[model samples]
Target: MTSTQETTRPRDIGGSPGHWRRMRMWATAHAVDDFYQGLVPAAVPYFVLERHFGYVEASGLALAATLGGALPQVPIGLLADRHRLRWMSPLGISLAGIGAGLSGLVPAYPLVFALLLTAGVGIAMFHPPAGRDARRAAGGSATAMSYFAAGGSVGFFVGPALATPALDTLGIGATALFIPPAVLMGLVLLRHHDRTPGATAEKVRRHGTDQPGRFAALTSVEIVRSTISTGVNTFISLYWIRHLGAGSGLGGTALTLELGGGVLGTLLGGRLADRIGMVRTVQLGNAAMLPALWLMLACDDKYAALPLALLVGLISNIPFAVLIKLGQDYLPSRPGTAAGVTLGLAMSAGGLFMPLLGVVAGHYGPRGALTVLATVPVIAILLSTALREPVHEPEPPRATPSTTHDRHR
Candidate 1:
C-alpha cells in the first residue's frame, strides 16, 4: 500500500497504535470509579436489613445517589469541554471512592445521604472527561471504546461481589474497606493525566456546529434501550426466584449470566461496528433483543430462562459502545455534551421509568412488566432506522491538473 493510503486508512479494529497503553490506564481508573457507582445498590440491602430502614427510606437514599451522580453530568460535560479540566477525572474518582468508603462511618441517615451524594458527584465528574479522552485516543475506532466500557462492566460485577462479602462480615461500615483502590488510582491518573499525546487537541471547538436533530434522535433511542436494561436489571432475579421457583443461588446465577452477557456484548459490539457500519450493528442488536426478551419471558423452566436472559442481555447491550461513539459523532463539536447525555443522563432517566414498570408488575405481575420491557426495543429499532448518520461537510475538491491547465489556457 502507498504511504498516503496507509496514513489515511481507518484505525484497526483493535484500536489506533499506542491506544492500549492509555486505554489500560484510563480503563483501570474507570473500573475503580464505577465500582463506587455499582456499590450503591449492593449497600441498599444492608440498609434495609441492618439499619432497619423501610423501603421508602432505602429508595430515598438510592434516589440521593442517583440524582447526585446522574444530574450533574451534563454541566460537568460542559465544564470539561469548555475549560479543559484535566484533573477532574482523578479528583472525581477519588471523591467517589472516598465518599462511598466513608458512608459506613456516618451514623446518621442524613450524613449517609450526604456521603452517597458526594460519591455520586465524583462518579459523575469522572465520566464525561474520561470518555472524551478515551475517544480521542480511540482514533475513530469504536472497538477501543468497548475496552473502556468492559472495564466498567467488570467493576460493576466486582463491586457487588466485594460488597456482599465485606458488608456481610463487617456490617455496612465495611464499605470503608473499598477506599484504597480509588485513592491509589486517582493519584496515578492525576500524575499521568497530561502524559498522553495531544491532550489538548480534542478540546471543544468554539465555532463548530452540531447536528441537533441527529443528537436528539440518538438520545431518544438510548433512552428506550436504557429503560429496558434497567427493567431487566431490577427484576430479572425476582423473575427467576418468585416466578420460576428457582433457588436463590440460581437466581443469582441468572443475574450473573445476564451481566456476563452484557460484558461480552460490549466488547463484541465494537468489533461489529468496525466490521459493519455502526448504525447497522446498532439496529441489528435492537432487532435481536426483541425476540430474546420474548424468549426469556416465555420460558417456563428456570434453566430455560437462564440462557434466554443471557441472550437478551447480550442483544440488549450490543449497541452500548456503538451508541456512545455515534452520539459523539453526531455532535462532534460538543463531544462531552454528547457523551454525558448519551452515557450518563439517559441512563439515569431510564431508572425513572422503572417505577412505571413496577406499577405494571404490581397490577399484572412481573410477566406483564417483562412484556412491556420487550416492546421498548421496538422504539429503539424505529429510531435507529429513522436516524441518519452524521455527515461531515466535505472539503472543496482540490483543483485537478486538467482544471488548472484549462484555466491557464
Candidate 2:
C-alpha cells in the first residue's frame, strides 16, 4: 500500500460526511474506555484499604493496572494496522467495562490485580484502533489526533471522580461501574451497524517522507521525559498531603488545578504551533515546568503546597498535549504505533522508575523527588532540539488570466 494512499483525504464508507461523523462517535467511545483504565490509580487505594489489603499490596494493585495497560501498545498497534478498527475498538471498550465491574466483585488481592491487568490490556487495545479511525475521519492532521487524545483526558478525570463517590457510598458493587462502557459499546454498535469490514492493506507510500527511522530514538526521549515529569507530579500530590498535612479537599483542589491547566494547554498549544512551529512550542511547554517545579520544591509552608501542586499540574499537563501531537508528526504513517509507544511504552517506563522514586522519597523525602522531576523538562528541552520540523506542503497559488496572455505574447 502506498503511504500517500494511507493518508489520502479520509473518505466516508459511502463517500460522504456521515461516515466521518459516525467514526468520531466510535473514537469517543473507545477513548472513554481508555480513560477508565488510566483512572484505576486514583480509586484503587480506597478499594485496598476497605478490602483489608496492606499498603504494599494496595500499591501493587495500582501498579499492575499501569503495567498491563501500558506494556501492550506495540502489539496492539500492529494488530490495528493489520485489521479493522470498528470491531476491535468496541470489543476493547466492552472488555474494559467488564474489567472495572469485575474488579469490585473479586475477593482476593491477586484476583483484583488480575482484573486491573485485564482492564489495562483492554485500554491498550482500544487506543490504537480509535486513534487510527479518528485519523481516517479527521483528514490526517495533528489536529485530528489532538482532539482524539482530549477525549481520553476527559475519561481520566471522570473515572476517578465517578468511582470515588460510588465506592465511598456503596462498597465497590456500584452499577455505575458497568454503565459507562456498556452504554458506549451499545451506542457505537447501533450507530455503526453492519459497516465494519476487515481492513485491507493500504498501499505503502513510495516517498521517503512516510517512514521514521532514527526518529524512533527521539520518540523514546519524549516518552521518558514526559513520564518522569508526570511521575513527579503524582509524587507532589502525595507529598503535599503528607508533609504539609493538607486534607483530601486541598489535594483534590491541586489535582483539579493541574487538569484545568491541561485544558488550557490543549486549547492554546496548537495556535502556538502554527505561529512558531512544533519545536519552539514543545520547548516552551517543557521550559514552563522549571519554575513550576521550583515553586513546589521551595514551599515548606502548609498553605504553599496547594498552589505548588497546582503549579506542577499546570506545567506537567500542557506538555502532554504538545508531546502527543508531536508524536504523530514524528511518524505520520504509523500514528497508532507512535501513540502506543509514546503514550503506552513510555508510561511503563514512568511506572518502572517509581521504585527508584520511592527510594528517593524514603531517603531524602518527596521534596527531593520534585527536584529530580524538575530535571525532566531540561532533558525534554534537549531531546526536542534533535527533532526536524515536519515539512507541510503549502497550497499552490491560483493563476490569473492576465498572466497567461502576457506569457503567450
Candidate 3:
C-alpha cells in the first residue's frame, strides 16, 4: 500500500468509544507491572526484620532491582522498535511478579537479591513494548497517556498499602499473595493481544524526521524533574518533623498528601497539555514550581505547610505525563526508546543523585536538603527552552493509476 493509504488507515482515534477501553487495558497492565517494583521497598523492612539483614544488605536488594530495571530498558526499547513484541508486556509482568513473590519464600540474601533483580528485568522488558503500544492506543493524545501514567502511580501506592498489611499479618511470606495480580493481568493482556487480529503486526510507521536533539533536551528536563521529585519525597517528611516541629504522624501525613497531589497533577497535566500544548504546559509547570516550593519551605507552621506540600507535589508533577508524550512525539520513529528513557532511565538516574542530597541533609538537615532541591526546577525550565513542538510530516501524495501502470511496465 502507498504511504498515504497507510497513513489514512482506520485506527483507534483519541476519545473514541474503543479508545478508552484500550487505554484502560494498557493502564491496568502498567499498574500490574509496576506493582512489583513498589513491592521491593515495602518488603525491604521485612527483610531486615525477619532475615536480620544489615542496612547495607537491605539497600542491596533495592539496588539489585533498580539496576535490573534501569540498565536494560533502552536496549529492550530498541528491540521493540525493530520488531513486534506483543508478548513482552504479559511476559514481563509475570516475571516481575514471580521474581518478587518468590523472594520472600527463600531464606538466602543472595537469592532474594537475585529474585528482585530478575523482577527488575521483568519491569524493564514490560515498558518499551507496552509504552509503545499504549502511545499508539492513545492516538497521540496527552490526556490519554496521563491515564496510563496515573496507573503506574496508583500501582506504586497500592503495592505498599496492600503488602504492608499482608506482611504485618502473615510475615514476609505474604508477598506470595501479591503474585496473583501479575499472573491474572498478564493473562488478560495476553488474551487481548491474541484475540485482536493484526494486533501483533501493528507498526508505527514514521513520517517525520527523528529529533534526537530535542528528545535529549526533553530527557534532561525529565531527569531534573525526577531528581526534584525524588528529593522532595525523600526529605519532605523529615523537613516537616525536624524543621517545622511537627509530630511523626503529621510528617507521614504530609508525605501522603504530597503523593495524592501527584496523582491529581498527572491527570491535570495531560488535559492542560492537550489544551495549551505540551511545551507550554511543561514550561508553566516548571515556572510554577519555583513559587510553590519556596512558599512551602518558607512556611513556619506545619499545618499551613501541609497544603503547600500538596501544591508543590501538584506543580512538580504537572509536567510528568507531558514529558512522556513529548518524548514520543519528538522521536516518532522510536517511541519505544523514548518511553524507555523517559519512563525508566530518567527516573532511575534521578534517584542516583540522592546520596548527594543525603549528604546535604546530614550536614544541614532536611531543610537544607530541600533547599537544594528547590533550585532544580530552574534547570528543567532552561532545558525546556530548547524543545520545540514536533511537526509530523505530511503523507506523500497518492500515485496516479496511470503512473502505477507505467512504473510497473
Highest lDDT scorer: 3
Report the number of clashing residue pairs per model.
0, 9, 0
lDDT of 2 by residue, 303-377 (tens): 756666656665555555456656655666666676677666765677677778888888877767767887767
In Å, residue 224's CA in model 2 sits off its true spot by 2.6
Report lDDT per candidate. Answer: 0.81, 0.63, 0.84
For residue 78, give model 3's deviation from the true position in Å.
0.6
Whole-model alpha-carbon lDDT for candidate 3: 0.84
In order of TM-score, best first, we have 3, 1, 2
Locate the minimum summed-lDDT window of 10 residues in model 1: 2-11
List TM-score per model, in order.
Answer: 0.91, 0.81, 0.91
Model 3 residue 90 lDDT score: 93
Number of the candidate with higher TM-score, 1 or 2? 1
Instruction: Report the lDDT tens digits of candidate 1 across residue range 1-409.
Output: 4222222236456545455664787678778888887899999889888888889989988898889889999999888777678789899999999999998878788998999999999989998888877776665677877888777777877788789889989999899998898999988988877565442334323324588887888889888888988898888888888889989889888888898899889888988988877889889998999889988888899996788878877888899888888888777777777778877898778899988999999988777888899888878889988766556453233346798578648
- Show where candidate 1 strays beyond 4 Å: 1-11, 14-19, 197-200, 203-209, 392-409
Residue 248 accuracy (lDDT) in model 1: 87
